[model samples]
Structures are given as structure tokens and as C-alpha cells.
Target: MLHLDASSSSNSKAISDTCNIDLNSIIKIETQLQDNPYDMISLVFLLYDVPDTALQRLIVYQRVMSDVSETNINLLQEWYCHASSRPNWQHELLEALMICQLNSIVKSLGFHIPTMRVFYLSSDPFGSKYINPVKKILYHACENIDSTNLKKLKKSLLSYDINVMEHTTCEIIFLELMSKKFITINISQENKTDEGIMYNVENIVNILDKLNGLKKIVNSLRYLQSKPNHDTIKLKQDNTNYGVDDFNDLFDLINQIMPNTLENDD
Candidate 1:
């Protein structure tokens, strides 16, 4: 049974401390769904923050099927229509956690948002009933790439390490992972990492602002260009797993915290 005693309170605090997801980000996504149900949604999960969690959510397609589904929101459409849309927009692979989890919210609000590709960190601990329903509704979106851009993308991923927060900029590499259709990217935290080194939303936006291109996104001066990778990973000896299991844990935590959502105050 659920406890309400001091011990329970302590446990709750522990849970809150251990389980963290950007609740505001989740809420904002939900709110957008509430206001614009027909908009497409695309999401990316960074399986490096909270293992076994769906870290980031991006909506990439808007297909209003049934009346119940019509009330849902779509991210891809909104982004395209929005003044600041991300470049190389892939309208097929939207994230599933937020959209599926919010199905009730969508129906209550009287809308629907179709999902596309929502990938997982590595398959373990990342399994969810959500994945099945989402897969039933949408087709898979990634495979071995054949495009020349993929080489560049892989080179970029190598720069990212995907298992070590090597550079001062993590969010950048995380976003880069999302751009390459990766739902999660793992990073090593064995060493005492630098919060100062981890690029925050504002720093990334400033970088984009400095960029000569993508004038629209930069113009918004929005602190966040995209969602931050939120998965938490656990590493073992030899690190042969590198970060898959860790990323999977990230998903689990994401599943727990995403329901509450966080605000972008920082």
C-alpha cells in the first residue's frame, strides 16, 4: 500500500531526486497539444541522462484519423508553419512517449496527433507498452544510411563520442544525435563532469544566433533550439555495453518523470 508517513515522505524525496525529466518541457508539449491538436509531433530521446527513459520528444507528422484522434497535436506541421523550424526536417520519425502518453489528454481536449518514428536507446529496459501501440500506428524510420550526408553525420557522431561527455558542449552533441535520427546518445560520467562545460539552453541558442544561417530560428532568440537529451545511463566494467544499459535506465526514469513535465526556467 502507498505510505503517507515520514518514511514515505523521505522515499518520495528520494524518488524525486533520483527520477528527473524536464517536466516543463513535457508540460509545454502537452499544452501545445491542447491548443493545437492537429499539429504534427517529432521527438528525440537522449538515452544518456536517465536510463530506461524516453528522454526527448519531437513530433514530425500530423495525420488526423478518427474523431478521438483528431483532437491530438502534431509537431511537424507546427514547426514548418512556425517562424522558427529546424532544418533538414524529417516529417516521418516523430517521438512516441509524449504523444501516446498524452492520448487521454488529447481525447479530453478533442484532438489527435499521429506518430511516426520514435526510436529507443538500445532495446533493453527500454521496452514499453507505449512502443507497441505507437509502432502499430506508425512505421519505423531508420536503418543503415546510404546517403553521403550520413558519412558526415557519422563523422559528427564520432565527434560526439555518444558515450563520453568529452567536450564542453553536451546539448550540442545531443541535438546532433537527434538530427541523425538517434533517439538517445550515451555519455560517460565516470569522471567528475563540469556543469560549466555542459552547454545549457541559452548557450546553444547563442551559438545558433551567431550562426549566419537558419536566420529564423536564431531570430526567435529562444534559449532552446530543441529538446535536451534527458536519458540517464549506468556503465559497467570494460564498458563493453558502452552506454546502452545506461541509456535504457534513462528511458525508465523518463517514463516516470515525463508525466509531471518541467518548465524551462533556467
Candidate 2:
């Protein structure tokens, strides 16, 4: 359990923060997994976000091979190509490996898995499934939007059966979307913790882009980068669990993105 501490070196930061994998590393890793291409395919299967049926369709369409070993290897390579096309493929791959319990390979490759809190604070949304800064940033971006943008946002959600009210705040709209499962959070009810809720936020970013609010979000992130302390908010270390106030402060760090605009806006 390697946590991404604030003390990580600059060179390490370059590797840990990014989802990009070098060609040489990719080649070496693939070669190492030649002995168990089946495990490799399983890892690829986990890395894929789509349903298993989609993967089966891809396999049938691309490489319908009779030889099991060769087919598995080819499929692994194909999946690597597909996964690498995604912006956060490396992070996704690391997560997939963890899920597949490939600890030996993970250690051999020197993959560092950061805590969900660290991922939430990071600029990369794909680092963890945690819902925090990204969600809060989008929510703040929606605050005090003009009527035109509101109409645009409303129209976008019409397909999801979300009727945005003239006076509805961003919080209310997001809550509604979450309730309807249009916006999902990755949290387990059986093992609930203050670790933070996981969410897929790219859709929110796309919606904000349509409303012309993406620029504001970008600027807000730039502000956070300039003031890193604001982004690296320390959660209270009291109990094994956290209370409501601690959670509020944890997620509300995005409010510092643009105080005058997000906070004071009506």
C-alpha cells in the first residue's frame, strides 16, 4: 500500500502523476506476460470499462482464432492498443492489475498505488473513482450561470429526464441526476467509509463544456496548481471514520477555486 506522500521527488512525480506508458516499458511488460497471456487478457478485460459483451463482440469481429494461446496473446495486444488510446489508460491499467490481484507483476513493474484521497486531490480524474474536486469543481462552475447557459444545460439533460428549474442550483440538479442514476457514484453500502464517493465525471465535464463553463473550470484548476496547498486539503484524523463536518470540508476544497465568483455569486 504505497501512498503518494507530498514528499515524492520531481522525477517520481513525473511517473506517478501521469497515465502515459513508454513504448519500451510496454514491450517489456508484454514480453514478461508471454508465459501467462490468459492472465494478461483477464487484466485487459478488467481494464475495459464497457460490458463483457462488447469485448466478446470485438474479439469475434477482430480476431476469431482457433489457437487458444495465440488468440489470447493477440487479444491482449489488441486490448492494450484499445486501452492505450484512452487518456488515462495507464492508471486504468494499474487499477485493472490490482483488481486482478497481479501483485507480483505490479511489484515487478514498480507500480505505485495511491490512496483514494490522493487521487481525489490529483489533477487526473482517472487516478481513482473518488468523487471530489472534479465533482465540486463542476458544481461550482454551474453556480451563477447565465440564463442562456442554463437553457443549454437543461436541454442537454432532457434526454435523461432531468427538468432543470429556472432557480435550481447546481447542487440540486446534481443530486437529482445522482438520484436518477444518470450520474453515478462508486460507493459500497456494505463497507461505507469516509474515503469519499467514487464517480465518473467526464460526462459532467462534457456538459459544462457545452454550457461554455469549461474555461472557468480550467482557470479554477490553474488557480489550484498555483496554490497547491488549497488542492491538498488534509482531512481530520480523529476517528477511524469521519463525521458530516469533516466530509463537508473535505469536498468543499474546490470552493477555493474561485472565491469571489463561486462563493459570493447569487
Best by TM-score: 2
Error of 2 at 167 (Å): 54
Clashes of each: 59, 1
> Which digits, one per residue and each the tens of the lDDT, describe model 1 over residues 58-90?
221122333565544433333334311211111
- Runs of candidate 1 exceeding 4 Å displacement: 1-33, 36-177, 181-232, 235-266
Q: Where is the poorest 10-residue window by lDDT in model 1?
A: 83-92
Q: Rate the local accuracy (lDDT) of all candidates.
A: 0.30, 0.44
Q: What lDDT tens digits, residue by residue, belong to model 2 across residues 33-121? A: 76664455454334433334333533452343345555334444555666554344454455455544555665555433222223233
Each model's RMSD to truth, in Å? 17.4, 18.9
Question: TM-scores of the models, in the given order?
Answer: 0.21, 0.33
- lDDT score, candidate 1, position 23: 34
